[model samples]
Target: MAAAAAMHISTEFINLKPNIWKKPDRASGSCCLGSDDISRKRKLPILLFDVMDTIVRDPFYHDVPAFFGMPMKELLECKHPMAWIEFEKGLIDEEELARKFFIDGRDFDLEGLKDCMRSGYSYLDGMQELLHTLAADDFEIHAFTNYPIWYNIIEDKLKLSAYLSWTFCSCISGKRKPDPDFYLEVVGHLGVEPCDCIFIDDRPTNVKCAIEIGMGGLCFQNAESLAKDLSHLGIDLSVPNI
Candidate 1:
C-alpha cells in the first residue's frame, strides 16, 4: 500500500506499460507535417533520436522496483529518495545516485547497487535495422537524449556513437529535455533550423514540445510505427537486408 501510494503518475516518470505518454491519444501532439514536403524530394536532412524507449528498451522503470521486491508501478515512489532528475542533468554522479537508491539506507551495498543499476539493458526491437538503414542512406543521425552519464555504458556497449555521427546527451549538455533551452542549444549547436530536424521520442510531451519548436517530431511507440512514420516522411525503412 505504501509503495502503490508513492508511485503517482507524472511526466517525470514515464514508460508505464500500455503507452509511455501522459496523453497517448494525442501521439505526436498537434502535429504539422511540414517535413512531409521532404517526401517529394525523397531526401532526409537530419534525424534526432531520444535514447530511452526510442533507441533502447526502457528497463529502469521496471527493473529497479523488481530489484527491491516491489511491483513496477511503485518505481517512481521507490525512486523518490533518489535525485534522479538531478542525476539526469549531470548535477550528480553515480556515487550520489547510489546513495539514494534505498527506502532505508542501512547496509546498502553500493557496488552491488551500482551494478544492478548499470546492467540489464536491451535494444528496442527493429531499432537496429532502423538505425542501420538510416545510416546506410547517409542520414546525419544524432542522439539528442536527456540521460545521465551511466548511459555512456549503453552507448559504448552498443556502439551508438558509431551509428549516430553525434550523441547530444543531457549529461554532456548539463540540461534536461522539456526545458526548451535544451532543444534550442542542441539545434543551435548543429546549425540547423528546428524544421530541418526530425526528432523522435516515446513521450508525447517531448514530441509536442519539439513540434512546438518548429521541428518535425514523432511520438514513438514501437519500431513498426516508427518505420511507418519515417516512410511517410519519404524515408522507407524495411527489415534490414542483413
Candidate 2:
C-alpha cells in the first residue's frame, strides 16, 4: 500500500495537469522540488488562506434565525445547545437545518434567503488588492476552508473565483481543519512537502496544527497586521491601498 501510494504521487508530480478552473492554456506545475532542482528553479511560495473570519468578516446576521423568517431571540434562548454542537461537528447540514427550521415553517424563498446571506457577507479590507499583489508576484495562492458547498456561495457572491488557484473545502474532502491528516492530504494532493507550504488561519489551534505537521503557519488577526507580518517574513506585499 505504501509503495502504491508513492507511485501515485510520483505520477501526479511527473504528469502535471492543467488548472481546469483557470485558463485552458495554463498548466498546473509539479509541486515537488528536489535538492538539485530547488537550486536551479525559482521556488514558488504557496500561500494557503483560511476563509470566513480570515478573509471576510463573518457577519452574524447571515446566521440569524430572523433571516429565515424565524424568531431570532427565541431560537437563541432555546436550551438545546446540543443542536449547535452537532452542527459544528458536521453531523447536521446547514441547508437541511435551515429547511427544517425555516423552509418548512412558512413561505420561505430559498433565493431570498441566499441573497440575505450574501448581503451580510463583507470582504476584509485590502483582501482583493492583496490577492492581486500576490498573483502579480507569481506566488501560488489557495484557500482552505471548513465551509462545505458554502464555498460556492461565497465564490459567486464575492466573485473571487478568478483570483485563487484552487480551493479545498472540508465539505468536498470529508475532512476538517486542525487535523494532521487533513493537512497531509492537502500536501499529498499538491505534490509538495510540508516545508514548501505556508498556512494562515485565524484560529491558534489551526495554526498550531499546521506547524505540528511541519508546515509554516501564521495566525491572522487582520489583513493589515497580517501584511506587516508577511513582509517581515520576506514576502513582498506592496499592493496599492484598497
Candidate 3:
C-alpha cells in the first residue's frame, strides 16, 4: 500500500511538472545569460553538487561516533534510523531529534553533537579549489543537498556560498534526494531542461536518480576524479596556475 501511494505521488508530480527553461530577466538575482551565453548555446551543464560528504566533510561517520565513545557499527545499531532522516526532511526539529536520537531514547548532549559536527565541517580535499575553478569559469553551480537547517552551521564555518548557492537544500525545499520529486523540483526551479544540468554526489543512488530523470550525473569518488568526469563531458575544467 505504501509503495502504491508513493507511485501515485510520483505520477502526480510528473504530470504537474513545469517546463522551466525560459530565460530570466536580470532583476531576479540569478546569473543572467549574458550576450555570450555559452552555457545556453552549448548546453553546458549547470553543476549541482551534493553538500555533505561531496563538498563538505560530514562528521556523522567519524566525529559523531567518536564523540559518543562508540564505534560506527555500535552507533548505527543504537541510533533511531528514522530520526535522522526525518530531521533531514525538516519534518522534525533539533529538539525532537535529540529526544529520539537513540533507539532506547536515552538523552545525549545535543550541543556537543552540534559542536562536533561544526568542528568537522571542513571542505573535502581539492573540492574547494574545484568549486573555485568552476565558479571562476562561470559554470553555474548550486548546492543540491539533503540536509536540515543546520546547514547554516556549515555556511558559517566554510562560507561555501563563495562557490555555489545553497539553492536546493532539503530543509528549505521539503524534498530529499533519491526521491524523483527533489530532482524534478531542482529542474523546475532552475529554468533548465534536465539535460542542461549535471548532479554530482558521493552516493551512487543519488547520482542514479538524477540520471534516471534525464539529467547527467557523476558519482563523486574524489575531486580529481570529478574534474576528469566533467572534462569528459567537454566542459573545460583546466585549473589555472596560481
Candidate 4:
C-alpha cells in the first residue's frame, strides 16, 4: 500500500484508478515520504476544500424539496436516513439510492430528481474566481468533500478539475469528514504533516475536527471571507500574471 502510494506521488499526473482500488493506509505518524521528498514538500500550504455548500451550491435544501413538492422537514421525514450516508461512503450506488430513498420504499421520479440536482449544481458566488487565483498561484488543492458518486455530475457541468483535483472525495475514499481517520489517511497519502495542510468546509463541525487534528481549518462563509482568513494564515492568495 505504501509503495503504491509512493508511486502515485512520484507520477506527474494523478491516476484515480489506483487510489480508488487501494486507498492509503491509516496514518500512523507517516507513510510515504523519504528524506529527499521531505525537503521538496514545503512550499504553499496544501488546500483541502469541501464541496457541496462550501464550493458548490448544494440543491438538497431548497431545490430538492421543491422538486418533491414538500418542505425540508416533510422530506426529511419521508427519506431514508442512512441511505444518503451510505451513498457518500460508497457503500451504495445510484440505483440502490433510488430504491431506498424513501423510508417506506415508495418510488418517486428518480431521473427527474437527478436532473433537478444536476441543474442546481453551480459554483457559489466568487468561488470560481477564487479557485482560479489559487490555481494561478500554484497552490496544491484537492476536493476533500463528503459527496457521493453523483459528484461526477458536478464535474461534468463545472469542470472543477480546472482548479483542483477531486482527490479526497468520500465516494472514492470511503470515508467522510469529522472521521479522524479520514483526515489522517489524507495526511498519510499526501505524506505531509497535519500542520502542512489547510482544510476548508462550510460546516463548523467538520472544520473543528480538522483543526483538532492540527490542520489549519476555516468554516467557509464566502470566498471573500475565506481569502481574508487564508491571508491571515500567511497564505499567498495573489495570482501571478502571465
lDDT on C-alpha atoms for all candidate structures? 0.68, 0.62, 0.77, 0.77
TM-score of each: 0.77, 0.71, 0.81, 0.83
Q: Number of the top candidate by TM-score? A: 4
The reply for model 4, stretches above 4 Å from the true place, is 1-37, 238-242
Give the alpha carbon lDDT tens digit for every residue of 13-63 in model 1: 354221111111123533222344533343345789998878886566666
Name every residue pair that clashes in candidate 2: none
Model 2: per-residue Cα lDDT over 1-242, one tens digit each: 01111222233223222111111111234334544454245444578888777887665433646654445455444324333333333567766544443322433565775676677677788887887778777777888866645566778778766677445776666667776888999888876677677788876667777877767778777778778767776685876774
For candidate 4, what is the total of clashing residue pairs? 0
Cα lDDT of model 4 by residue, 100-188, tens digit: 88989988898998899999999998899889998888889999988888899999999999999998988888988779999999998
- Tell me how far the alpha carbon of residue 9 in candidate 1 is from the true structure, in angstroms, after superposition: 7.9
Candidate with the larger TM-score of 2 and 3: 3
lDDT score at residue 75, model 1, on the 0-100 scale: 51
Model 1, 164: alpha-carbon shift in Å? 0.9
Q: Show how many residue pairs clash in every candidate, following the order shown.
A: 0, 0, 1, 0
* Global local distance difference test of model 4: 0.77
RMSD of 3: 8.2
Worst 10 residues of 1 by lDDT: 17-26
Better of 2 and 3 by lDDT: 3
| Model 1: how far residue 124 lies from native, Å | 0.9
